[model samples]
Target: MTFTPVTPSDIAPGTTRFVQHEGAAFLVVRDGDGRVHALDGLCSHALLPLAGARVRRGHVICPHHGARFDITTGAAKGPPAHCGVSHYPAQEKDGMIELDLNP
Candidate 1:
């Protein structure tokens, strides 16, 4: 996948934002340390939208069944979600947040 540009200001520190690229939904988050991460917007357990999912302790808690996934590695960190979601490489460039959708 190619790098898609997004508004950096839309995602604040310690918050999450939903973005669409090439007709696919993606979740972009800014950690407490101000680092950006990108992940597939759907939960692996039931394919539920993870847009409003809570971010705590470096994990995104699924709103549907309480599944938690690591923001950095996309690893499943709790029950009800044995499988992990997909993670994309993200970085800041030219005052924008760029995500590698193909990663």
Candidate 2:
């Protein structure tokens, strides 16, 4: 699978960043534990942007509302979001965050 590269420094630990790769929006997250994740940038609940969302206890809380999504599995963890967003394969390589969008 092809991979998209993102600067690791762009996403600090315990933060979420908005990114556009290959014409699609994505949320790059660095959890409190330093694990990286890539998920659809829009909240499934209302198709709202998750760019500045909050990360708590391995979950990304939607900024628009109170919906929560699992950073690892992209599963909808709370109400108003019954459907999960796409979870892309993410890894660190060569000092950058690489995302497999086609995975």
TM-score for each of the candidates: 0.90, 0.91
Question: Can you write out model 1's per-residue Cα lDDT over 1-103, one digit (the tens) per residue?
Answer: 5788965645778888887777788888899899999888898999888978888999999888999999999999998999998998999888889998766
Q: Could you give candidate 2's per-residue lDDT for residues 39-80 as a string of tens digits?
A: 999999999889889999889999888899999999999988
The list of candidate 1 runs beyond 4 A from truth reads: none
Candidate 1, number of clashes: 1
- Identify the runs in model 2 with alpha carbons over 4 angstroms from their true place: none
* lDDT of model 1 at position 41: 89
lDDT of 2 at 62: 92
Q: RMSD per prediction, one decimal?
A: 1.6, 1.3
